[model samples]
Every structure is written in C-alpha cells, then in structure tokens.
Target: MAEGRRVKRYADLIKRVVSEVIEFKLNDPNKGMVTLTRVKVSPDLRIATIYYTVLGDEKQRAKTKEVLNRSRSFIRSEIKPFITSRWLPELRFFYDETMDYAERIDSLLKSIKNDADSEEE
Candidate 1:
C-alpha cells in the first residue's frame, strides 16, 4: 500500500508538471489539442511515461508526438521541482489510444443496436 502510494504521488506530480510545461511553454504549432491522460512511473522512480491524446487525425497526432518528443529535454529541464532524491526520472511520451478505442466500441454498439431494431421492424 505504501509502495503504491509513493508511486502514485510521484506520478501525479509528474503529470501535473508536464502538463503545465506543455500548456505554457510548448509553442509548437503542430501540437494539436493535446490532452494529458495519464502518467506511469517506475517503482524505482527512474523513469516515467506520459500518456496523451491529440484531438486530430493520425497525421496530426504523429506530428504532435514528434514535437513533444523533440521537446522532452526542455520539459525535463523545466520540471526541476526537487521532487526526487536521485533524479527527476526520464520522461517518455506516448500517444494514448484508449480514447479512440472506446469511441470505436461505442460506435460499434450503436450500430449493432440499430441493426437489431431494424430487424425487429
């Protein structure tokens, strides 16, 4: 329980700081309406992966991801809040597709319901 709490605390801090850095510092026009979804940090607190979603097509998503990755170092340097004892954990950015998957599932279910209703009529 304590272990989980520690990781969660660090993850929350990292997420908040990274989101702020992206929102205020990042000026790349290619960055779409990005939403910082979640952050996962290693138990050893040596690495962190940030999950996010871009409100656009795959091309735009890819572009935003490229911009984010290019600015990873800047973000790391900007987020020096002394939250860690050893280091501020390596940050890795990943495009979260769970939102897309959920939307796909919802559409499929709606179509299935429509098909069932039509068959009944």
Candidate 2:
C-alpha cells in the first residue's frame, strides 16, 4: 500500500539525516566511533527508532549511547528543516546487536569446520 511505502521512505530519510547529523554535526567529546546501522519508523509516523553500533568495548558503547541520548533534542532540531511532516517523530536510540550476532555465528561456523577437519584426520 501507499502508506507502507511512505513509512519506508520516511524511515530511509530519517536514517540518512540522522547519520549525517551524528557524523558531521554532533559535537561531543565522549562519543566514540558511532555507526548508524538502521532506522525504523512507526507506521503512524510518531516514533523513529535509530539503531547504531560503536566500534569499541562495552564502555565505549555505553558512552556513545549516553551521548546519543543526551543529544537527541539537538539531533531532532538539526533534522527539522529536512522533515516535511507536520509533527516531528520522537527519536529513540538502541544499540544494534546484529553485528555481534553475525560475528558469533561466523566463529561458530569456523569452529565447526575445524572440528570436522580434526575428526577427518
């Protein structure tokens, strides 16, 4: 349906805008290598959840998350010019775990292969 497409488009737009804002506009000394993985916008267009990953340890991830949360208002204001919607969707951030899951799967597969090879020997 057209509504679904609109929501998807909106999510993509929000994702790009947030990524740029975080990459070039955000000014925080405690933030680390924050990477925006994806954005999900509700069908009602009332909430936009942004998922991100930090290329560092748990402490770095936590710090980045804290920074993002603290800067949510600034980010919203920065993207206001680009948003055509009458109401700005609330921004919620979450740490993306897909990368970690993928890495774990890769290691498990490698271990399985190694075990099979050892068994063959």
What TM-score, computed on C-alpha atoms, does each candidate reach?
0.95, 0.96
Model 2 TM-score, 2 decimals:
0.96
Taking the tens digit of each residue's C-alpha lDDT, what string does model 1 give over 1-121?
Answer: 9999999999999999899889999988998898899999999998999999988898999899899999999899889874664877888999998989999999999999999999999
Q: lDDT scores for all predictions?
A: 0.91, 0.94
lDDT of 2 by residue, 1-121 (tens): 9998999999999999999999899989788888888899988898999999998999999899899999999999999999999889999999999999999999999999999999999
Q: With candidate 2 superimposed using the best TM-score fit, by how many Å does residue 13's alpha carbon deviate from the native?
A: 0.8
lDDT of 2: 0.94
The candidate scoring highest on lDDT is 2
| Pairs in clash, predicted candidate 2 | none
